[model samples]
Target: MKVANKNIVVTGGGNGVGRELTLKLLSKGAKVIAIDVNQFALQETFRISGKNPNLLIRVLDITDKESVFNFAEEIVSSLGHIDGVINNAGIIQPFIDLKDLKFEQIDRIMNVNFFGTLYMTKAFLNHLLTRPEAHIVNVASMGGFFPFPGQNSYGASKAAVKLMTEGLYSELLGTNVHVSIVFPGGIATDIMKNSDITDKAASDSEKNSKLLLSPAAAASKIISGMEKNKYRLFVGKDSKIMNFMYGINAGFATRLIKRVMGSKMSMEA
Candidate 1:
């Protein structure tokens, strides 16, 4: 379904690609309900977008199932219907090996990245059904498809999202809702900082990598994928290349990813 004139909900709408998505959607004449845990970032997005009537910002913790359910009802009551949803909210794990990571850290990553997406999808699934046509865009990562050296827990969470989205697509094949899973490679965003990793050298190395796509470009590709109802969308050149390379030889891909990233980090697993 086209985004124009649609009532869409964007999770993680506070910053980065989410913020860009909100602005882009409004520019296309869509009414957007932007949800984020950070009120300040949401305000920043509002400021950047000029706070049009088409944009509504809400502070939400998507990991809280009850809160998500309540927000879904609120959207339905206020907007009459929801035309689409973009589950763009997710967080990465600290650059540490799986064995060295604490259980609390793993749980938090799973809660926000996996359960958060599930909650939003369940909360809004019925509402989306009532629309003439609806779309569900779940942002997974290349890490989900091809493992990253230090982001094991994060990758697992996103992999869960990727499979769940694909299952939804299969189940809703003849239904009104269409599902799209996005695999984004390195994107120019503050995810490391957001993840609270203080490894300045690691951050600098990542920033210096040639593979990172800009947030605005990633948003455009994502929006275009939603409009086109693509089953699996690869956002960056890195995503596309890695996906193909991984498909050809999973073992080789794994070794290459580890070789490129493992040396840069201090980890135990």
Candidate 2:
């Protein structure tokens, strides 16, 4: 649905694509409720937005189910209703093999990327059903469908999101709430820094790559897809290409990715 005059909620609105989404939505005359865990980053996003009256920044941990439900209630009470929600907050693990990765790391990734999206969707779903027109956009990753050696856990989490979103679409068919799943590939953002992980090789490669999509550009594509009520949206060219490649031959795509990113991955015995 068109976002103009709609009350939309964007998680991870502190920075990266989320921040850009918040700014662009405001520019489009949408009333945005931007949610993030980082208060400072949310403040910065608001500052960059020039304190738009249509923008509301909230600090909430989406991983906490109770907090998510409470936040939903508060928004409904204040704004009356919500038209859309973008589950965009997620983090990546270190560039290491799953065998070497700790249980804590795996849990953290799943909690934020999968369960967080689940909580947000569940929290606002009933309210969305009440609206005349509503939308739900869940941001998965290129690694969700394809594989990247070191990021197995992260990919798994996103894959869950991908399937969950698709399932929601099937269930919500004939309903006013439109469900869209997004697969984004290699966006130029501070994801590494924000995730508190350090990978010099990955960082250097991203810096040298000209094909990576900017946060602003990715946000534009997401909003456009939402406006069109698209079922699946691929943000970057890389994501689209990989989708095609995987569709043609999953084995070939897997091997190709392993061949390119294998050596860069850090493994431990």
Candidate 3:
């Protein structure tokens, strides 16, 4: 499932790893359609892409199923085919306890992180099935695998994404679609700013650390995995290590994450 010369769609392409994915896919000779909720941010991504002819930027809210279907129809009609889709758009819940989180806040996180990915995948799945070979890449998180005290809702939503992607991979077996689930650990990106979270405590902690992977490196690994049609892709060293740890002992992994992130998270509460 080489992305070169394929028609690929990337959601949340305005910033962070999504923006990097757009740039990397374009560089690999793919015709990329970058989707984002922010028009200004999409424009910024376009500007950073050197305005490549192969790149198309679209302002889209992936949570709207009707709109996603219509947009997928338009892409297939205009581009002549749909080869791949990267469900990368997502938002984080506030860094507070689950008891302190309102129902509406939980809804917002689930809608964007899980339902949004579901809608996009459903809308384009039929179109993808028509292709000789197609690909689906869904980005989950380390939090999806290991529990984070303050980011419970966010982690749950991503966990849903992880399971959904895995189910898709299983169901699509013997089909032309190559489904991949990505579990990304700490990465050097403005995800907090994008998610509208103001966690000064967590910000201070991050500033003192140099363990996060860069967006470019993460994107490179993702694209390479997609090209190889990999089933599971781990973006950072932290993701790979924690994956093994969690697999060995879930209780220990949960306690370790709590010990590491709980203090900073308590400041938000």
**What are the lDDT figures for the candidates, one per model?**
0.90, 0.94, 0.91
lDDT of 3 by residue, 1-269 (tens): 99899999999999988999999999999999999999999999999999899999999998788998999999899989989999989888777889999999998899999999999999999889989999999999988988877899999999999999999999999999999999998887777778878533246456335798878888999999999999999888899999999999999998988887877656745
Ranking of models by lDDT: 2, 3, 1
TM-score of each prediction: 0.94, 0.95, 0.95
**Model 1 Cα RMSD, Å?**
2.5
Q: Each prediction's Cα RMSD?
A: 2.5, 2.5, 2.2
Q: Quick one: best lDDT, which candidate?
A: 2
Tens digits of per-residue lDDT for model 1, 1-269 = 89999999999999888999999999999999999999999999999998788999999999899999999998899889999999999889887789899999999899999999999999999878878999999999999997898899999999999999999999999998999999998887887666667444245555556778878889999999889989999989889999999999999999998887876554534
Work out how many backbone clashes candidate 2 has. 0
Clashing residue pairs in candidate 1 (N, C-alpha, C atoms within 3 angstroms): none
